[model samples]
Target chain A: MKNIWTIAKREYDNYFASPLAYVIAAGLLFLLGGIFLIILQGSIQQAIFGGGTPVDIGFINQWFYYLLLWTVPALTMRLISDENRTGTLELLLTAPVRDFELVIGKWLGSFLYILSVIGVSFIFAIVANYLAEPGIDQVKMMSSYLGLILIAGALLALGTGISALFNNQIAAFFVTLALFIVLWLLIGIPASFFPSNPAIGDVFRYLQIGNHYESTFNAGVLYLSDVIYFLSLIAIGLFTGVTAVDSRRWR
Target chain B: MIRVTDLTKDYGPRRALHSLSFEARQGEIIGFLGPNGAGKTTTMRILTGYMPPTSGEAIVAGYNVMEESIEVRKRVGYLPETVPLYNEMVVQDFLKFMAELRHIPNPEESVADALNMVGMTERAKGYIGNLSKGMRQRIGLAQALIHRPEVLILDEPSIGLDPGQVVELRKIIREIGRERTVLLSTHILSEAQQICDRVIIINKGKIVVEDTPENLQARLVGGERVVLRVRGDAAELSAKIEQVKGVQRLKSNPDGSLEFEYLPGHDVRPEVAKIITNGGYEMLEMKTLSLSLEDIFLELTKEQVVTPKKKRRL
Candidate 1:
C-alpha cells in the first residue's frame, strides 16, 4: 500500500512535469468559461429585453458535462500506454511492486489529474453563482458536480483499462474517446433502431450513461440506481485494468 | 546468493532458455557472457522473479523464486537491458521513489547512500533527461543498489558506455561485488575477463563454457606454445626440437618459423633455444603463445556451415 502511494505520487509528479496536464486543465477551464459567458449573456438578454423568467435557464450547468465526453481522453491517454511506449513497463514490472499497485497507482494519478481539470472548471461555477439573477440551484448544482465526478471516474477507469491494452498512446486515446461516446449515448443507437420496442428501450436506457446522468444526477434528482451504475462502471473498469496488468507477467 | 537448476522457458513453443543452470556464491561477481539472444536476460529475469521459468527452480537469497517471489524481489536488485527511467524525475527523486517502491526503511538515507555509491550526490537534483547516457546508467545502478539488496542482477550495465565509463562501471560493479553477490550479463569478453571472478559463456541458449577467464584463455591453447621465427633448414631444426625435453609437438611454418607445443608445467624454450644455437640457426624472433578470450569465445560459438539444399529441376 505504501509502494502503491509512492508509485502514484511519482506518476502524479510525471504529469505535473509535463505540459499536457496544464493544457488539459486550461482547455477545460476555457470551455467552461465559454459556457459561463453564454449563460451570463442569456441571463442579461432576458433581463434587458424580455424580463423573462430564469427558472428554466438550466442549460449552462450541463454544458461542461457534455464537454467532458471529449476532453477526458487527453487526460487519461498516457496513463499506461506511455509506460509501454517508453519501456518503463519493464522497469515497473521488475520492481518489487505488484500488478495491482501499478494499475491502481496509474488510475489514481489520472483520477487526480481529472480532479484538477474539474477544479479549473469550478472557476466558472464560482462566477455564475455570483452573477446569475435567480441564482444557480445549489442542490441541482451540487448533484451535477457529483455527476461529473462519477462520469469522470467512470471515463478515467475505462480509459486506463483501454490504455493498458495498447502500446501506442494515440490508439489508446481514440479508443477511449470512442468508448466514452458510446457509453454516453449508448441508448441512442438502440432506440433509433427499435423505436417502438419498450423492453429494448428500457434496456438501452439502463445501459446508457446519459440516462443515469441527464435524467437523474444532472437534473439534481440523485437516485441510488444512478450511483450504483457509475460505481459499478468504475469498479468493472478498474478490474479489467488490473487483469490487463496482471497478464503482462505471462507476456 | 543465487542458484538455478534446469531452468527452461518457452514463448509459444520457441524456447528462450534451455535447461540453463548456474550459481553465484555470496560476494562473487559471476559474469554471464553470451552473444545476443543467448537467454542471458531471460535467466536474469527468472532469477529476479520478473517471470517464472516454465520448468525447474531458482533460489535467490535462500528464497524460492517461484514460491517466495515477493521475498526474492525484496532481496534482489535488478537492472534491465535498457535502463528504463522516468525521464521527468530528478536523480535524487527517482532513487527515493525506487527506495520507497522497494519498501526500504529510511528512504532518505538509502537514497543518499545509493547516490553516494554511484558518486551522483552532486547531481541528485538534476533532471534525468539532461544527464548523459553513462550518468543515467549510473543512476539506474543507484536505484538497484538503493535497497541494499543481497544480490544484484545487472544486464549489460556497460553497454553503450564509453571506454572510460566502461572501466569506471566495471570498477563500481567490482566494488559492489565485494559486499553482495553480483550476476551481470555482457557480451564484452574483455570486461568479463577483467571484472568477473568466474565467467559463464552462453551460446545458442546453452552453457558452452564456465570457468575463470584465465583458465578459459589457457584451456583453448592447451599447455604452452611458442612461435619461433628462425633462419634455418626445416629438417635440422625439427630434428633438434624433437630431442628437447618436454617438447610435445612441432610444426614448421611457411615463414621459416616453428610453433612449439610443449607439455604442461614446463617451458622447454631455453633447451630449444640452445638446440637452435648449436645448430647454427639465427633466431629471428621468439614469442610465447597465449590465446585471448576472444579466441575461445569464437571457438565456442562458431557456427557450423550448413550446405544449401539443391534446386530440383522440373
Candidate 2:
C-alpha cells in the first residue's frame, strides 16, 4: 500500500509537470462550457416563447456520456505507454511492489487527472443553474456529475489496460478509442438488431458502459446495480492491465 | 552471496544467454567482463528479477530467483545498462520514491544516505531531466543504493562518463564493495582491474576465465618476451639471437630493433647482450614487456579454447 501511494504520488506530480495535463484540462473545459451555454440559451428562448424544453434531459445526459468517452482516453494514453517508452517500466516492475499495486497506483493517478477535468466542467453546471428562472434540480445535477465520474473511471481503466498492451502511446490511444467505440456505441446497434434474442440483447447492453450510466444520470437515481456494474468494469480492467504487465516481464 | 547455475535465456529462436554459471561470495567485488553482445545485461536482468531465465536458477542472499522473487528483489539492488529515471522528478524526490518502492523502513534517512554517498546532496532538489548525463548516472546509482541491499548488480555503470566522473564512480564502488557484494559488467579492462577483486571474463555467453587480476596475469606469463634496441644491422642481430638455444622466435624490426620471444623458464637477455657486444653492436636498451589485463582478457576470450577445469591452479 505504501509503495502504491509512492508510485501514485510520483505519477500525479508528473501529470502536473507535463504539458499534456494542462492541454487536456483546458480542452475539456472549453468544449463542455461551450456546449452547455449553447444548450442553456436555446432552452431559455424556447421556454419564454412557450415551445417546451429545447434541450431534452436525455440529450444533456448523452452529451456528458459522449464527452467522457473521448476524455478518458486522452487522460490515460500515457499511463503505461510512456513508462515503457522512457524505460521506467523496468524500474517499477523490478521494485519490491506487486503488480496489483502498480496497476492501482497508475489507475488512481489517471482518475485524479480526469476528476480535475470534471471538476472544471462544474462551472458550466453552475452557469446553467443561474441562467434558469426556476433553477436546475440540484439532485439531478449532482447525479450527472456522479455518472460522469463512473464513466470516466471505467473508460480510464480500459484505456490503462490497452496502454499496457502497447509500447507506443499513439497506438495505445487509437486502440483504446476503437475499443471504446465498439463496446459502447456499436453494441447498442447490435442490441437493436437482435431484440428478439433477449440474452444477446442483454450481453450487448452489458458491454455498453453508457447503458448503465444513463439509468443513474437520466433518472437521477443511484442504484446498487449501476454502481456494481461500474465497479466491476473497473476491477476487470485493472486486473487485465496487471496481467499484461506481468506477461511483458516474461516476454 | 550470489549463485547462478546453468542459466540460459532465449528470445524465441535467438539465444541471449547460454548455460552460464558462476558464484560471487559475500564482500567480493567481482567484475563481469565481456565484450558488447556478450549477455552481460541479460544475466544482470535475471539476477535482479526483472526477467526470468528460461531454464536455470539463481540464488541471491538465500532466496531463489524463480521461487522467491520478491525476497530476491528485496535483497538485490540493480542498475540496468540504461538508467531508468523519471525526468520530472527531482533527485531527492526520485530517491525517496525508490526507497519507498523498495519498502525501506525509514525512507527519509535512506534517501539522505544515498544522496550523500553519490555526492549529489547539493543537487538533490534539481530536476533529473535538467541534469547532465553524469549527474543523472549518479542519481541512478543513488536510487539503486537507497535500500542498502546486500548485493549490487550494475551493468556498465560508468558508461558515458568523462574521465573524472569515472574515477569518482570507481571510488564510490570500491568503498561500497567493502560491505556488499558488487557485481559490475564492463568492457573496460582497466576499470575492472582497478576495483574488482576477481574478474570473470565471458565470451559468447559462456564463462571463459575467472581469476584475480594478479593470478590471471601470472597464468598468462608463459614466456619471457623482450624488445631489445641495438645500434647495428637488425638482421645480423636477429641471426645471432636465433643461435641461442632458448630464443624461440626472433623478428628484426624495420627500425633496427630485434624482438625476442624466449621459451618458458629461460632468460636469454644476458646471452643476447654478450652477443651484441661481442659483435661490436651497441646494446642500447632492453626491457621486459609486462602483461596487462587487456592482454590477459584478449588471450582468454579471443579464441574458443576449452579452459582446463582446475580451481585456482595458478
Each candidate's number of clashing pairs is 0, 0
Candidate 2, residue A166: how far the Cα is off, in Å = 1.8
Angstrom error of the Cα, residue B110, model 1: value is 2.1
TM-score of chain A, every prediction, order shown: 0.89, 0.87
Candidate 1 stretches greater than 4 Å from native: A45-61, B218-221, B228-263, B266-284, B304-314
lDDT, candidate 1, B121-188, per-residue tens: 99999999999988889998998888888999999999888898888888889998998999999988
TM-score of chain B of 2: 0.88
Tens-digit lDDT track for model 2 on B1-314?
99999999998998988899999988999999987777898899899888899998899988998889889899888887889898888888888888888878898999989989999899989999999988888888988888888999998999999999999999999988998999999989999989999999898888888889777777765566688898878777788789998886577656666677775577887898899899998888897766578766766676544552322101
Off by over 4 Å in 2: A42-61, A123-135, A191-202, A221-229, B228-265, B274-285, B303-314
State how far residue A204 of model 2 sits from its true place (Å): 3.2
Model 1 residue A22 distance off true place after TM-score fit, in angstroms: 1.4
